[model samples]
Target: MRRNWIIAEFTYDDLIAVYIVDVSQVRGNLKQIDNSRLDVTYEYYPNDVDVFIFQYSVDLFMSDGFPILERPILNKLYERKSLYSRSGYGRVANQVYFMVEFPYRKCGLLSYLNPREEQLFQRWGAKEIHLTAAWDGKVIWRRFGYQPPEDEFAILGLRYQHWATIHGIEYQEPQNINDFPEEFLKDDCVKLITMYKVLEECI
Candidate 1:
């Protein structure tokens, strides 16, 4: 009922590591840091209120190619904010999905501290971390021993009809961005790409 988070920042050697933990769990010991070497900061984020930390592209759904969208119109919907997984736990109980990892770059290896982060998430009682990544995200995740089960998909597609109505954009089931009126592309264009990963350990 009370969703809580603990964000911690530490300087380990040259890497300035920052991570989040869910405070809901009562089991497991929090990682012990060497006080002399530790320089850290902490913050809290609560549940009940959904937090939006980043924006994602809906560009892939704009036009279909490999792993084409099932329904371009239904699949173009987008949510401006990311939320905690009801499954619970991970970075802020997977509370806020940040658009931190992408095709251009990926989450870096935390060296020896990687285990500590995992232990922290386990301590926080996270069942899994859910996220949507571009198709290429699979390559990035695979290096970490995690892979998105779904190859291509979409989220927040229901808003398409309403968006079209307000923008005066024509409705088409098999939506194509090219067919869109010039004004629609200029005013309310949307896109998407490979939607990957949902409810999986993010270690």
Candidate 2:
């Protein structure tokens, strides 16, 4: 099928937004800005325009009792040139791989996020930003544009900015994103986490 993604870019005041779809509640006619549908596979649209304008993320699964990776921890360090956000759509769709981005400083009243991070997200044309304060290992898909499975969860597209513009209006300060996971804090996993932002988006 010849598919085309309806994309729009604008400043925060321009009212740009991300389309966050409830994957568990997709029905049909996703052509509308607020409308959404179930997750689709690559083979479903062989002749479609592979247009990924910004970053995106989704939760996923490997197998029964198989451990899912905390990829975002590493993925986040590459903030600007990368994509970040999570959706429970992966496991529901029976797949692996997700996306991740650095966490913005917590909001206080009405002006959260570091000016530098915000500028970076904006410069990358992300327009939208979404993330939960806490991590839910039982859930929470990684954040990035990974190959999608056949299912979807909550989808936040270009419309995410709208949510931020309205609700995330609060003061924010720099937050120290722990490079290492708690499992490694005591040197159990013994993995090292030394990260820095990458200038290149695609590898």
Candidate 3:
């Protein structure tokens, strides 16, 4: 599939802005610019054959045009560049692995990015999204409908028990990801577990 850059406009927190979907194709070097509002840039890196690394950074400004925060908020590494099917076989699926770092959690950035990400997935014909949820991501990604595999859940249960023991808290064997306590997600004792979300008929 040919790679094409996309431009999109978004309105969030009463702020309106336009951002490029793939900035690397256009900007070869980072240059300082005046921050009039929220500025977002997406970058694409071809890491290997059929694998790509994608990232987006944000420069946030207040309603009064005061710069608040500027940092990279999301990174995704994915494989299988396009949809393909072998003779007598069904369409093959691929996965996009991602990590997020949002300094301002309440800024509604994730809400703005989720749909755009789904669009990207559709373009790549990816059927699953995966991540290693740690720290706040454990709860955040769970809320976003990502779930750990059963085997990983069992391992998480063991880690949860150990964490509870160390904190002198009552331990209840977690039946699922939701069974884990919210407090445990905020701590470093819990092991980072693989979580995945299966997309519905992206094609």
Model 3 misplaced regions, further than 4 Å: 1-38, 42-44, 48-58, 64-70, 81-104, 166-170, 191-193
Q: On TM-score, who's better, 1 or 3? A: 3
Alpha-carbon TM-score of each model against the true structure: 0.30, 0.18, 0.58
Each model's lDDT comes to 0.30, 0.25, 0.54
- Tell me the tens digit of each residue's lDDT in model 1 across 45-106: 33345542221111111111221112210111111224232332333223222232132122
| Candidate 3 structure quality by residue, lDDT tens digits, 112-151 | 4565665555554456666677666778878777788677
Report model 3's TM-score to 2 decimal places.
0.58
* Model 2 lDDT tens row, 1-203: 12433223223322122223333432222112122221222221111333222223322222232212234111121122222233321101111222222221121101211223334444444423333322321122122212111121212211222333454633232123332223222332212222122123212
Clashing pairs in 3: none
Instruction: Please tell me which model should have the higher lDDT, number 1 or number 3.
Output: 3
Better of 2 and 3 by TM-score: 3
Q: Which candidate number would show the highest TM-score if scored against the true structure?
A: 3
Candidate 2 deviates by what RMSD? 20.3
Quote the RMSD, in angstroms, for model 3.
9.2
lDDT over C-alpha atoms for residue 192 of model 1? 28
